[model samples]
Target: MTMKFPFQIIDLTHPISPDSPSWDLDCGFTHSNFIDYEDCTSEIKFRVQQIHSPLGIGTHMDAPAHCIPGAASITDLDLHRNYLLTQSVLINVSHQTDENYQITKQDILDFEARYGRLKKNVFVLFYTGWEKHWPNPEKYRNNLVFPSISAHVAQLLLERNIAGIGIDTLSPDTADSGYPVHQLLLQAGKYIIENVANAHSLPPIGAWTLTLPWKIINATESPVQLIGLVR
Candidate 1:
């Protein structure tokens, strides 16, 4: 059977490769070609590649278990909660030129003032215009400091009961080890999508997000293929 989608599908995931940047605690992506078409005879025409890397290396989503002990893992997350196809809004904060900027409650409020209030179960994404530096370890990971979701803003989203939050940067929080935003959001049963690509392409509202992650049992996080369905 064939399926039809009513909207334009925009890919939001970054390709994972050996050079993919990873958090300090995670190993970089690596792969090996186990089978080559050249090695195959007339009887066998196939090739296989083996991938090795941490689940968090590429564009990925973080489950509650990523930070909180005994929390929901990637597989344990509710389909409705973690991977919902729902309404979304893009709060563009690229104007914040300061490195290591914090996305404050005012930023969210300003967005709402111009676009109306954010509804419940809506997927909120912040486009920092940082994806332009992707795959460059020195610029993307080390030198380019991206904006982060502040704790207060996290609380505001929690109060609004947003389905999930996504960002164009490596994480929703700063490079700091203590991720208060992650902790608060995850603890509230909200998931986070990091390293989102092409966020700048999305509109402020009227977009839908479908986040697809590997159902890895007991895994704290999983690399995801995010799709933005635009009307």
Candidate 2:
């Protein structure tokens, strides 16, 4: 039936590494072409000879020409708003003595007073549970504060006109240099989904937030092999 809903596709990716932990505020990830084969001698055809990357590397999504100077990249937006069947909301505020965990405005008004006010286009997912430092570089990018989203909850999800917003870790902007919530959500044209892995495996509410990015045209950010179809 393919319309399940409950929760558990939390994979806010970020394991590309020169030594893992990236972001001095830009460019870092290098996984090279690893051609491997054992045996295939029949009606066989295969070729994926190691594709290296840097469309903003690893578990990505940030188009609107990545901060709106020219705007509308990431394959010129509108792949049905990049796979939206949303209504998934999780706000955990990841803790381990909270290493600079930003995300406030009373955590979006206490999660809309406990799950209510989030409509418009609905697809906000930020569980900040930073996946236990997946590959760790002093717990992801030399931590100071990388659990983000707090320019007043990115202007209160653009005053609830919400059509997009995703995060599990890596770049929601707790400031490393200057991302200002990716320049206030693509300059209010709104759209942002980044590094979302195993948002602690869902179930903070009903689930069905399938984000699918990669139509790579002008490519400012791409590679969103997402899934969260629980029931």
Highest TM-score model number? 1
Ten residues in a row with the worst lDDT in model 1? 19-28
Clashing pairs in 1: none
What's the distance in Å from true for residue 148, model 2?
16
Worst 10 residues of 2 by lDDT: 33-42
Off by over 4 Å in 2: 1-17, 20-52, 56-59, 62-73, 78-90, 93-115, 131-135, 138-162, 170-192, 196-220, 223-231
lDDT of 2: 0.68
Instruction: Write candidate 2's Cα lDDT for 7-56 as tens digits.
Output: 44554455465554445544455556454343434456443355555665
Stretches of candidate 1 above 4 Å error? 1-4, 25-27, 38-42, 81-83
Candidate 1, residue 133: the lDDT equals: 77
Candidate 2 accuracy as TM-score: 0.30
What digit string (tens of lDDT, one per residue) describes model 1 on residues 15-104?
887777666633467788898899777686888889878888778999989998988888887767564578899999898887688889
